[model samples]
Target chain A: MKPVYRFDGFIFASLIAGLILTIMPLPDAINAWRPAWPAMLVLYWTLHKPERFGLLGAWLVGIAMDTLTGTLLGQHALALMVIAFINLKLHLRIRVFPKGQQALAILMLVLVYEFLLFWVDGVAGFATSGIARWLPVLSSAALWLPVAALLKGAMVLARRA
Target chain B: MAGLKPTDVLPGRGPALGTRLFLLLACSILLMVLDSREDYLQYIHSKLNIVVYPIQAAVDLPFALADWASTSLASRRQLLAENRDLRRQQLRSDASVQKMIAIEAENARLRALMDTAALMTDRTMVTEIMAIDLNPYRRLLTINKGSSAGAYRGQALVDAFGIVGQISDLGPLSSQVLLISDPEHAVPVEINRNGLRTIAVGTGDAQILNLPFLPNNADIRLGDLLVTSGLGGVFPAGYPVAEVNQIEVNPSQPFAHVEAAPAAELDKVRELLLIWPGDVQDQ
Candidate 1:
């Protein structure tokens, strides 16, 4: 019999950290390179435990993000919900892939997430900073490997504890 | 396995995936439409802002600590030199303010003679800029003041040098400022040299503002100073806004392509003065 899956404190802690990182101010030189921390964290939770942290969880996190960032209401929520849905459908196949292929898939997912945000901004008449708006997508993809490893280690530690 | 029903082959969750997605999508679209079209969501956003205050403060704590450390660790000699420099600067400004007081009195007397309404002095308060990163696409600042501090929406913000921005979103403990450098922002400005009025709009660059309505034959020169015209009713009159840096008068184009550098260091401002206009009584 499989063990029961529950929403754990570990996931809650990581999500809070992600929220903090998303709004943390950096030096202007590299501000554009700040990764989509919340999006990546949502992706991690959904991919690892879809039954526990599914579309509703992603939507809530996105709502918090929109409120924090002062974007048009529901903008981030919509983008993140779509990302969660895609991961829910493909987690099984993508999880089985090699590390490099998994990273590529994660990159595609982040790109889609950013594209949705861009589309929303365009439709809402919010002018986006040209080229600079796409920088986070690349940074998010590049940091995915290290973030995944760190989260995996933390999960193992939590399980042991 | 033979006895099990075919419908039970895959255990269904609370709701099907597609159904949930569609419901959530519909809800989000409704929210966006409501948010963009009206002010119905402002109250909810302001209330939700209280929940995120702690997160914003946590992110700001490190920077605050570093600033405190630097100030507390400064040597007495450096402090004394800084005090002396400030004293000299204060004396110079005091002399200028004395002259300004005289000029203001004479101007008010002249206005009274002309039977014009008295020019009311704006009430001002200092607010520190919170160290929080807002949307990168828009030039927004989160200041450490909110409705509790009597900061209302659409209040004008200015730095020592010039106008900075206006309050966009207000929470209970903090407010967000939409800088003049945002692409969506526009200010009515008149050239100080000629009083030729035009609207200066932000071009998504912190240093540049575009004046798109100026005719090619408009008597605007490079280095002309732009000041608020008071027509928009948001910003007060005669505050320096920008300085015209470039102008291209192309015969083919009806409107000249002109750009100006903002007078305020919009990207570097750490403290801002919130001004209540003459019409709005300061709380």
Candidate 2:
């Protein structure tokens, strides 16, 4: 590991990959279950590397996502900043938790993120369908371990280099 | 030479979380308000979308590759069958067009006799849909045509059957279309049975539209076809818009509740025609 910390390209590359997956088209039934990949990735990085990835980085990623998805600007940014803050504060405790507990924590955080989105959308007079937006929490929970492992592996490789 | 020191590299604490969250939240609220209420941010949105363009292109690559693979792998028999079907359809359409030419002349003469302005027949550009908005609340799709292809805001989109939607926003290489089935969209339509004019608004369902303001005594009936009335000046006149499927008149309610199925296959149409009105040139 380097003596001094720096912005890791691997983090960004993973974020971009997450961004691509976030916009990837899926069939109708599957689309409703689409995980909030970008937000999830931001959470992972912020939790694992809070010194490097924090609220501002998460905000930028969210804005990029807003642009990619053509949602109202700043909508996703707000939700992601909130998620990042929560993760930053709880990263130590979260890092030591069992996988099942970690998944539960993620589920709660993601639900909060999605609820903020739902509330913002409502306040902005945009209509949303019933219950489908919540479906992603299950998907995000299911994929948390695998995604965490992948990001952990990437980070390990990046540090070694 | 040492073990992975994850916690050592990442300090347990960073900036004051509350203050940063508050500031970011405030900034985001400001952005949301400005973005929703004004058109000024559109310049920024368009410019920022350039950054997003590559992600969209990359995401679409797999689907494109799959399409190419399937087409290449198709048997000669399938290709021949498709070609034969298209040829037959083209010939039938050609015969119809020949008849339409004479009918169009007669229509022009009648309009001239009546001193009414000639109907505006638009020049159309074919565009393929690239992506659909996954948000259930909004009905929108991105099409390959954009300002580069002479697509402009308010340009009408149509499938083979009828009006599909209007161009809501455009980027350099692609444009977003707001479908007629979006709750925010309203089309002025005339009933084909009796020429009764009314506004049909989307009910937030792709398959249905609501004729909300029609009076209880309106002569609309089940299965009556509704066509564009040309009142909006967005959609061209005389294209089929919807078919009346249900009518419910409540004595207590001021207006009848009429529902119609949109004529255009809003959910299934993959290709669209971008219409430029003949009278108004693209700026």
Candidate 3:
């Protein structure tokens, strides 16, 4: 039987990796295309293990992201909270979907995440207009499958250990 | 399949999801409002930034390793060639320094005769950039120096070419610099050719700055050099800021559509010099 309350170092490691990836420097042209790793990680964890990773964890991770990226404090926290809340509410339905449908669901979640960020940016007076603002949503969706697979593989390894 | 899973029923024990979400949302809004409107959160941010410094260093490790490997693995012949090129450049600059010293002495004597205050040389320290903000619109850079090294907020920074930016946030180990090319940044500048003063505002593109206040009949022209007038007391006087590259005078518009290219390579700068402008001593 799976240990219901075992400490999961794998989750912590994955979260750290996600934060690192979010702030990793890229070239100007490709920077816009970088995926929103924190949002994806929050969605993934909250979907897979809502009991452990809930709104509080998501909010804390978002705050870390805000600090790392130097955005207005709480900007990412608000977005990630909204995404995690939605994922928690519908995880049962989403979990049963096929891989393609799962990817589509993840796409929608990422879109909502980016939209919240864009809206917050507008309200904070740092609004930037262009296709660049929406580029990460598409990239995050495309990369979701591989990222999920990688995280699942790590989890499996951790469980075996 | 009909048996209810423990995981499904377990999460409902806490405060309802809606209440938790609403509370978190309210907390976020409060933090944002305080951060944007006041300096209350800056102290907390600076302390929390210590936790973030390691992650930034780890992210920078790959690039740092590449730079180290390239330098350490270079052939002797290549090193010799580089050394020779640097020596030649140093010699050229040394000759210019001699001329500059003579001109400076003459200028000081003239200033004394005119009863004007003497110019003081700014003190500067070199710092390497640790990270660049991923958000293209923000244009912030994190440098290795911080309060430990006398870095303070609003301190001016420059590269080898010209004015780069100013320090906006300070941590114990590192600080964030707001680049002059960020859309929100503006500098007071005057034309080197005619002393026609105007404000050079950032356009979100590192290569371009807009002079929105220049009138149609302003004595600004293409290829004109822009230098800091030191009117704002934030930047030192006579620092090269940008060179006017485009000018359009419209008969209908009240202000001419003028643009200039930044003197510093804002997008590619890997190192910057943090400057402390010398105080003008009163007689």
For TM-score, the strongest prediction is 3
Worst window of 10 by summed lDDT in candidate 2 chain B: B6-15
Candidate 2 interface RMSD value? 2.4
Which stretches of model 1 miss by more than 4 angstroms?
A1-7, B1-11, B132-135, B279-283
TM-score of chain A of each: 0.95, 0.93, 0.94
lDDT of 2 at B179: 93
Top model number, DockQ: 3
Error of 3 at B79 (Å): 1.6
Model 1 over residues B41-121: C-alpha lDDT tens digits? 889878988988887788778878998998999999999999999999999999999999899999999999999987778
**Which window of ten consecutive residues has the lowest lDDT sum in model 3 chain B?**
B1-10
Which lDDT tens digits does candidate 2 get at residues A28-123?
Answer: 779989988977888898887777778888999989877776678899999999988989889999989999999999999999899989988889
Residue B94 C-alpha lDDT in model 1: 100
Q: All candidates' lDDT scores?
A: 0.86, 0.84, 0.88
Candidate 3 per-residue C-alpha lDDT over B218-260 given as tens digits, one digit per residue, 9 for 90 to 100: 8877899999998898889899999999999999999999999
Q: Which one is best on lDDT?
A: 3
Could you tell me every candidate's TM-score relative to the true structure?
0.93, 0.91, 0.94
Model 2, TM vs. native: 0.91
TM-score preference between candidates 2 and 3, better one: 3
lDDT, residue A10, candidate 2: 77
Error of 2 at B184 (Å): 2.3
